[model samples]
Target: MRSPVEPKSAGAWRSQIPTGKALVPYLLLAPFGCLFAVFIVAPLVYAFYISLFRDTLVGGRQFAGAANYLRVMSDDKFWAGLGNLFLFGIVQVPVMLGLATLLALVLDRGQLYGEALFRLGLFLPYAVPGVIAALIWGYVYGPVFGPFAQLAEAIDVPAPELLSREAMLFSIANIVTWEFLGYYMIIFYAALKAIPPHLLEAALLDGASRWQFVRYIQLPLLRPMILLAIVFSINGTLQLFNEPYLMRVHAPTVIDSSYTPNLYAYSLTTANQQYNYAAAISFVLGAVIACASYLFILVSGRRRRR
Candidate 1:
């Protein structure tokens, strides 16, 4: 019906132009894509590029291939930091998430007196800046002037040395749990609220007890949120820096420059002037986080299938 030239000249332009809903997804994603590429992707690429080079006074910056990465693999400080995170995560994450889940479920029931006050009180700690929270807790863990120590003295009992080497990990974990528990609880509470009211009503009409309804209906629905929380917790755990870094002031003997991988990377850059090696350490930690998160996703997916 139309000449070939006409199709090429006119139809080509029309075909190239997206119409209506064709552009919706791209339009919706444009802002996030720009920010993600600028902030996340660009920095990651730059870090990885930096990691492949070595900077020294003798030779300046030189391409070292994977020398930095190889060094990182054998670095005892890095491994020890990771081991601390692993220990912190194993004990902290489950307890924190479980408490969050329980609190969210209880709040969602709308049975508690002064529910709004309780929610706000729980979430208030999350609003506090991480640095400020750590500082506050640092003083609380100080044996000299801390309330716990004062109370113990008043009661004629020995004060628990919370910042001692034996308890430093638990002390940091406690701070992290206190800071994040309310955040995760809000997430779970929101997910619970999103469940359709009709389904809950149906369960109630079917003579389902609260425990039975929660076990069969709510828990199943909350799995995706649970998995998301776990992944986030894993990432946060591996990147632990703030609590330990701040606590180092209080427990100088227990917390060192290389207390966590993030702290180690920071110390390398600022204290040792090893920017390239620091970047490598950072990228290595990032890779560890990615692999851990991926493994968790696979496991959760397999469990969901079952």
Candidate 2:
């Protein structure tokens, strides 16, 4: 049993501590909290406020309540932008994640020569800025001066019309896939490395084939990271902007003001100065992303339970 003096001493020590000292940890975090409140929280709140109004040159400005959201629901251009995102996400995400997983698996196997150098090389492309990657790939896809065109000319074949409407979305997808593949690869690779080696060794001892081990062991362990990648990809695809924005110059006809929801909102805010409507569009996009994230979490939870 503890002595009464010890308990009293502990209580006295705690009581002796200054009340202000209790706030030291929060005080340390104050700068970041202030910045986040000012930048992130303030903007979101302001945007929501703006979204509740109607802005027009003739009508000036008026409180519209949910009118902007109603307008967005019936907006054809808005749905078209969403359709583009849905198509892009549906096709591009799986391909990029699949390639990333394959590379991570290969690197994790430890059989490849110069594994560190190979891994570094695989990840280096992700270091390139999105704008720069778009420009580089745009140049490569250019119908006239691009090497691909020259190669086609030399072979007496037609240069691929990569900037055409039929292929523009896919061309943009290629750029996106190229830009992010290394990022997801590095993520999956880290997850793979974090997996305990003892489990793998036991599987090997049990005469598990490579496919059997990966299918039964690695895939299960990888589910969490895979879900994370899916969520990130979902957000990225729905908010697609940079690649398409940059590609607009090279493929102006195909890439227009309403190319993606972000671009559409941007055009409305800047070009048409429809700030309220643009805010509504932005909020809608955010809501869609939130719902998508929720569904993914729900499905993942169900799958894990099973």
Highest TM-score: give the candidate number: 2
lDDT of 2 at 124: 86
Per-residue lDDT of 120 in model 1:
90
Tens digit of per-residue lDDT, candidate 1, span 1-306: 125444357556666678789899989999999999999999989989999999888998999999999999999999999999999999999999999999999999999999999899999999999989999999998899999999999999999999999899999999999999999999999999999989889999999998998999998899889988999999999999889999999888788888899999999999998989999999899899999999999888898789
Task: State each model's CA lDDT, in order.
Answer: 0.93, 0.91
Q: Model 2, which residues run further than 4 Å from truth?
A: 1-19
Which residue pairs collide, candidate 1? Answer: none
TM-score of candidate 1 against the unseen true structure: 0.88
Could you tell me the lDDT of residue 46 within candidate 2?
99
lDDT tens digits, residue span 153-179, model 2: 999999999888989889999999998
Clashes of each: 0, 0
TM of each candidate vs. truth: 0.88, 0.92
